[model samples]
Target: MKQSVTVEAGGARMPETTTPHHFVAGIGAGPANLSLAALAGRHLPERVVLFDRQSGPSWHSGMLGADARLQNSWIKDLVSLVDPCNRLSFLNYLVTTGRIFAFLNAQFTAVPRVEYARYLAWAAGELGTVHYGVDVVEVDFTDRFVVRGRNGAVATADHLVLGLGTRPRVPECFRSGTGLIEGAVLAEHLDAHLNRSEAPPAGQVIVVGGGQTGAEAVQCLIRRGYRDIRWLGRRHWFAPLDDSPPANDFYRPTYQKFFYQLPDEVRRSYLAEQAYTSDGISLDTLQEIYRANYEAFLRDGRAPVMLLPGRDVVRAGSTGGGLGLWCERGSGGRERHTAGLVVIATGREPAPMPLSAALHELVETDNAGEPLIEQDYSVRWKHSTAHKLFLQNRGRFTHGLADPNLSLLSVRSAMIVNSLADREAYTIRDEQVYTMWA
Candidate 1:
């Protein structure tokens, strides 16, 4: 039997088409939602349904550089943290794909990003619950949740899950006529641009933003034979990531619970203090950049990359047929530079919720207008508790820093699954608590 989805418009409906009401309808088929689908099980057909705008399973494909790797371990995959025996474990993916021994022999400290992306795709394919090429535009509720996509097909569900990941943050200075400045591209697109043309001009290439993306951009430029590269950052210096044991204690489930119970003001302070754990550039990347610069300096007279920190990009304009950037120095001074091309690697923020106007009014929000997510990952709304809306990758303020990190995907999904099933579907055990966070 062919299934049909009714299209709903303003005031009137398209036609009479039968649509199956799902127990849970998910809005993005990324890792977060994929984790939930993996643990939700395969016994029930209509238990979960996911929609994504992508035509296929793809994750950060633009930024998958040759040497790029994952920050977190492979053990924190879709289902491992909670249910390793689940059909969609990363280990299972390797074994089923007949590469377990080869992968073990490689013995990577952290797996490659490309491999992780393939693992995610394998999990998505194995689950077979994702509806690709469907962009969910609006979501509201009446008797049940109504999800309307850009293609006009609609779905209904008793509960909803939103796993819309983050989008790159465009700097304020780059908002020109078309909201984009020529010769300025995001770090994500730089690789594609380099692939098309691997040559550099006479003018220097400037990379803005000081985090991992910025570092990666500098490294990419260096590898492509761009000799004159300048890196600018707001921080005092290019700091390496603090992957120490004490810093990692904050990522445990017990610590996550503790951080959630803290006051909002304290949470903000802690996030500021502990931002580097999740945001800083890896030591391996730093060493590579330094080593590459050394090798280049040994061969050529001039170094490849110039590290300039404590400078904030204040303005940008055209000068000498190239882009010129003005910056305010942190130590009470100013500087300017001209570049043939500029790469913006600032950071990423969560994608906006696609809730309809009616649905938006029912949900409670913090001062920043972000939806307030509960401990179980459910949003606080005016509707009955029976119909819930859960949000992922948008609760960094309420939850700990682990909210946005991929280290706790399965644990967070387990929390949501337990709420939906109205039972303890997965047990989250963090018994090895040696560090007492005061």
Candidate 2:
């Protein structure tokens, strides 16, 4: 069992026993909490800790394709947006690792996803507040919040921040057939599946989903020399991400503030209408796929990939020693395809909240049973005035498109830190907007 230290409070020595105490205890050491830990550690070193179930620092390690690149700019790192002077900035990482010159020489429009993952690991190592391999099971509130892991009570905190990121969303058609089918795999697990499979390079493969992940999966299959590949998507065309300046305005703090002031219905409707701003395939990646297809066609006189857009995979099953997929076409017809391997890259949903029954009862929820997140990302619960329970990446409905994107990571962290300390720890300034969102 872990032990605790005592300190003098109110002119008396308190007997602090085995469990550690902190001002804030965050669950999950993803970028969201890692950013918070980095900022909090500077001001309140050893006063904030993050618990993660993973054994080590990794961000979507399985999906780190050979050519996968970050959709956002490198400057939108963990600390630079709010506190560029902080020691854990991405620029500092490059300088410390002696890769600044080489990185600049490369002139990458978007840095590789693997490089960003390494930057996060480097920051996590510097902070040294993440407790890995500790699966925080339940969180209950009494005098303060008690965070219980598999071993027992890991720590207690005056406030809690849930950054339990997201999990890969499996379609209902593929859910039951996952283990029974030999070659079925989720996008996140494709790397592992490819490593161990004995399938031939000429095998037929199906890549489902229209977003970035789906495009990446198709590229991976083509690189692996898969001759017959079918790419299916629900959209009429494989739409490229709207990364123009005006589209990017939606990710700024000014637009976020304007969005938060709108009626709930309007905000929700806008999000539905503008999903492509954040969820579409990168233009570069789409171009690469097209160029690759054209080059291969010129050499072999046949294209390897068949782009089957406007089709939604509705049913899946096993057929003739392979996986069979049934898709509902946008033009009102049903189509079927059989492939030796099927990769599902649909999307992701927020991970389940790790609140105990009692604590969950105290927190107010919306009609969908999600916690009512406020403008500052704090949950509107019974004890919110006294003790806060903040959420990260769980406010797309409340905070707009910027909530899940990496563009405003530091800004969000600064907001949470200010809320926790009841004072401004980092100044958040957004000025001189060209567009009037009001």
Candidate 3:
């Protein structure tokens, strides 16, 4: 794949592109790109637009359970850390929509996930840079970045920012020759599946995965009055998040900077050690589930949720009445359980970068075949510094845990903006430094 070659426009051969049309072509309209757009509104000289595949903006709608609450604080919104005065701030959304007082009165320990989704939609509406319904299939580059959608070259940019969020991890057992196994559903689609159900399912309901999503699936089942429910997790027990002050230090901008400077071996170890801080279920959520179980126990002789934490579902098959699953227990041996329906609450991985073959050949990658991203989230490509490619929420390996997290969203955006603008567009100030990683 040569740098100077005919690029495909839809199916037709288009001439090679030379001049840049947009300053930055952001590939996803999620929170990360939204943060960049919010801060770059006045910073960049050229036009900056984000193209999303969705008909409109939505954040984790499938997993927005009725009782689901965010593990992180509300202040971790799109533009607060760097630009609190930005119109897209979560506080502004609450106040503008006349829910500020009500929100304050409710005194939620953590804001509801549904509310956060709504806030994202609101922010998307306010930010005029997003162009929805454009499914960017591939991105090609010649002299300038060419972002192509399902149709043709939708936009060209001097720089590219890829922020396509993660996708749900569907296990092999759930898939079949034709399609997904019968009566098997991913956690993201559980709500819609339940809604469309003609009646309450008979027999036991099994939810696999011990993370927050898994717990939520169990809670949803309990709320739906599923008396016999089996909750399985890989861990020995459901782990609660370490949200203490010391744990939170890892999420700070100062800490992010420190973590970026460390060697790969040290960084990998630190990431493994601090996984629970970002990955574990919230303590409050666990308490809620336990309380619900307590209530069910008091109301009936048996509880609805039977937590089998150490069991790993090894095999699954469609049975006469339901589905039969074999679990490998942590203690020892294997056991079989049947379920009317199965909800896979397994985790997610970073989405694939849709770079064209020519573009991919130019970008440097690590031994794992991942693009070698710098501290500022810029991809080390075989191109001029004036033209660059940036990554958002796709730099956890390079930028520490905070890279994929919402804690330093605005700060990250600010760094990207400053880098592109070649000036300090936003002052990223985190003066208080109690613990030093260096």
Model 2 lDDT per residue over 1-438, tens place: 222322211233233345778878899999999999888755653456888888889899987888899999998999998888889999999999999999999999999999999999999889877788777788988889988775567778888999999988878888763453455788888878888878678778899999999999998988888878899999999999999888999998889989998998999999987788999999999999989889999999988889999999888888985899989999998989998889988999999988999999998998999999988899999999988999999999989989988989999998998888778888888897899875
Query: Residues 323-399, candidate 3, lDDT per residue (tens digit)?
Result: 88888999999999888899999898899889999889998999999999887789998994879899888788778
Identify the leading candidate in terms of lDDT. 2
**Predicted structure 2: lDDT:** 0.86
TM-score of each: 0.95, 0.95, 0.94
lDDT tens digits by residue: candidate 1, 1-438:
223332322333332145556888899988999998888884334557888888889999888887788888899899898898988899999999999999999988879888999999998888777878777788877778888775443677888999999999887887687656877989999988877865644568999999998998988888787889999998999888889998898888999999989999999999999999999899899999999989888989678899999999989888886898999999988899889899999899889888889899999988988888899999999874888899998889888889889989999999988888788878899998987776
Candidate 3 — what's its lDDT?
0.84
Off by over 4 Å in 3: 1-20, 177-179
Error of 1 at 261 (Å): 0.7
Clashes (backbone N, CA, C under 3 Å), per candidate, total 0, 0, 0
